[model samples]
Target: MDKVKFGVLGCARVFERRMAPALKSAGNAVLHAVASRSLEKAQATAGKHGAAKAYGSYDALLADTDIEAVYIPLPNDQHAEWTVKALAAGKHVLCDKPLALSVSEAEWMAGAAAASGLRLMEGFMYRHHPQHKKVFEVLRSGAIGEPVHFRGIFTYPATADHAGIRWNPAQGGGAFLDVGVYPLNAARWLLESEPTEAKAIAITDPTSGVDSHTAALLAFPNNRTASLIGGFDQAFTSRYELVGREGSITVERAFQVGESGVRVLVRANNSDTEEAFFFEHTDQFQLEVEHFAACIRNSELSLEPGEDGVAQARAQALVLSSL
Candidate 1:
């Protein structure tokens, strides 16, 4: 199969530090071009990342005939607009998560992709990691026996810059829309059910109008519920627990899978044991990029398709509305 040609939509920190390296590592993907509102930034990113072309405008990058796909790492609110434009430009898109602020916008993005016959995928890198797959496997093995309750938390200190994206409400910034989506989606994927109801509270930054902390509860059927805690004002913590009738499971550093090992503690029937699963040092970003490239090459939907993105967006909107 021919390598998929890729254009990057921005010179965001994520692009420079993460996606660009992942694209370089993908066996069947090429970083063909990049764009930024500033020509200098665009040129610098293209040069640093070996992109063949640079455009001062996103539309110019989308119009590149050689570019078969585009990765949009734009702000949350801009996801829908750029995704629609990229699809209309005849380029498949891999957009950053929380695809849009509302389900309506996500549906519009899905419609655009369908009408254009172009693939559109939400960028959920952790889902592609093998460690997460192991978690799914353990859950399916009945080790956790009929999950009853879940507790998930993802927290980190806020960025030092006041102008950072996470502090910009106009950019769709907030604890729930940002880190909170990870735990929310993880719960949805593990439970294999959509949340029937959501309640959330937020501690907002008065100056920025963005949330600094958020706590939410998602109610599922079978009298089950998931507690989600996320914020930008706390020390680093990424952990999850699944409590079942027979036993329980706890995962540390649940969101990031690394080379060292993944710790999974399983307790059942009054017995407790732990095991560490190790895998090759694979970059989640590379795995995600490879998945998108394969989908674009085959004209198929990616693992986390637009529908999943829309579902997550709906859940996010529900939480936001409650707050």
Candidate 2:
């Protein structure tokens, strides 16, 4: 039972709170090292996470031969640049979501990974949850008849940190990149097809030049449709519902489940029957890391590789352009 040694490229908040523990706990992965531009921060995170080493710079961490994999939680704008660098350095990469700001950057990163013969994945941890698998299973069983429409919403109250990256346009801060990617990807996954057209409208925060709220209608192949909403200025809500010909399925915690059990509610028999399915607390982040690490060790384990991220980027770009 060998474990992949992981070097994390950033000490971002998500890394500190969730991914650090996940990388440490994953059965097939080890948090070997962490890096940040600030030596002090890197050292503190390493010590806290029980990582073996810390580096003052990303290059230093990438140069470490012992590190077999890299988890990148860098800013949205840096995902491509650092992922390419990590891949070029002969390391498998697990990058944060909205893999890149544009399709070009995502494609470039995918190309680098392909050329390097290294594994590359985007970190959409929610998709790794068994709850989603159950939903798919239910769909397959025809419990929902045929999924035709999806409505997703992910929002959190506006941030108070005006100077933070969430409001910083240069860092690729926007509702779509920050949270909308979930529903966009989910629509494709549940609908089982790429969207053919997108119509979107956004409420931009004039002060910050970042979209505070974005809503879109996606037209999928065969007349399947989806409505997605993402926002940084709204009541906290994270959920999605799929409406089918005969029934509907709703996931209460569609994303960002942090050690909490989630519920999947369903209505069937033409809305005359109702049932609920429960998935006990399972750390999706740990599952995500372990899956990727296992794929790195054994070629048999399938993965949502970098190409999927590129497709996601294409949809994202399309949504923005439509807006």
Candidate 3:
């Protein structure tokens, strides 16, 4: 239990470029194995990531007695099935977001994790970033007054190629499921409350039948509200603003703060000057890995636990159902 040995469920690109490096950097975690449908791909990824083992199928990795946990970066549609299977195999799970395509799927995954007595966390790595902690600090400090409204924008232009997995409806591809979850999760996180009612408008691609652009409004308790815009057909932009009666805070490059520093702008009502907070660069993914490992060794769940994923999925379902 000194260090958690993790087997990757898929050799996805994100694992190769981000999560694997984070795992290696985590002091209390080790990349033990990698699995892919193709043995060669698994071997290549495992070797590149310095993993000790590789398997052709996910089942093989799950069966490895040495692997105490699994990191799942599979397709959005496959999250629930693999998470349940991994939990059934007696392994803690850190699955990518959105945790599942629907509320029922998320509930099933959460139930399996609870039944198995294992830690199951949705990989919303941004929550581990120091910048967000600073944002919360500012909000709690009352510098921005009482946060009454929030808005987030996450969008990027789609490629000319229409065959990408994100463009495939069968794969759970859509603006809301893919990127909208970020803003939704963020609003809930910062607001510290779940949305009670939701509404959305989405522009579906004629060819893919997947949402290319979506705008959603979520109504929280205490008369608080949040607005989010996610799109696969707009200029690259990721930002959010929290507006209060007396002031407001704005965050640029919100979701992918990465190793680059982050800045939060605060403007108080009736004040001519704006206050700015800057945070040093941090590898949020590494922090996330260490946190998951720590929770595993300590026999606990994450601060952002499985129930948060369920709430997020429920809110998302409400939005999608409205459309």
Candidate 4:
């Protein structure tokens, strides 16, 4: 099968720093084109990444018949609009996480993909990392008994000025929308269930009106629970724990494990020493792109898909409502 020809929809920092390089390395995909609001920037990005085509605007890239799939790393607010446009142009889509600011927008994006019979996946790159698979394997082996509780943390001290697009609510920037969704998705993934109830609290910055920190508790079925915290008001950490009846498991450097070794720790109830699982660094973004390409090329290949994105937005909406 031919590699999926991917057209990048924006010059987002994530693209330049991560996804562009990942797409270039993916065995099942090619970085065919790149577009930006500025043609000069687009040209520079294409030259830097060795993309074959560059367009002044996203619409131009979508209009290009050669691009078989599109990767959108746009601002949160722009995801739905560009996604629908790309699908309408008969291309599969892989949009960045927190798929949209609201569930309605996510549904619309999903609906467009269904109407066109195109593959649509949310770009939760970390899920493709091998460390997470190890976590699940440990759980299945009963190292962690019947899963009962989850604690997820993803936070960092903002090194940049506090006045960027992240501080703007209209741009769909906030602690929960940005990094908090990772824990939310992780809980749903590991628990294999959805929440029945939710509660949350957030500390909003006065000048920005965006929550600098958000903490939430979600109650899942069968007495399972997850407590999550995400923000720029704390030291850098990306980790999560799953506590079962007999023991607990912890994943270190969980979400941001780019090109670095990762660890998972397991502690039994009466253990003097804890067991450990280690994984060597791997490019999760390349794995994610390859998976998306496989999904595009065959109906049998599973995808994270649009409905998952919609559910993620729905859960985020619940947390926002509680705040």
- Model 4 residue 114 lDDT? 88
Clashing pairs in 3: none
How would you encode candidate 3's per-residue C-alpha lDDT over 160-276 as one tens digit per residue? Answer: 456877888998998888888899999988898988988899999998899998999989999999999999999988899999888888898798785569888888764768888
| Residue 130 CA displacement from its true place in model 3, Å | 0.5
Task: TM-score each candidate.
Answer: 0.94, 0.97, 0.96, 0.97
For candidate 2, write residues 255-310 as lDDT tens digits: 87656699999998697777999889988899999889888998767785335887
All candidates' lDDT scores?
Answer: 0.84, 0.89, 0.88, 0.88
Model 4 stretches with alpha carbons more than 4 Å out: 160-163
Clash pairs (backbone) in predicted model 4 = none
TM-score of 1: 0.94
Point out the worst 10-residue segment of candidate 2 by lDDT.
298-307
Off by over 4 Å in 1: 299-306
Winner by lDDT: 2
Taking every candidate in turn, the Cα RMSD to the unseen true structure, in Å, is 1.7, 1.1, 1.5, 1.4
Tell how far residue 316 is off in model 1, in angstroms.
Answer: 0.7
| Model 3 TM-score relative to the real fold | 0.96
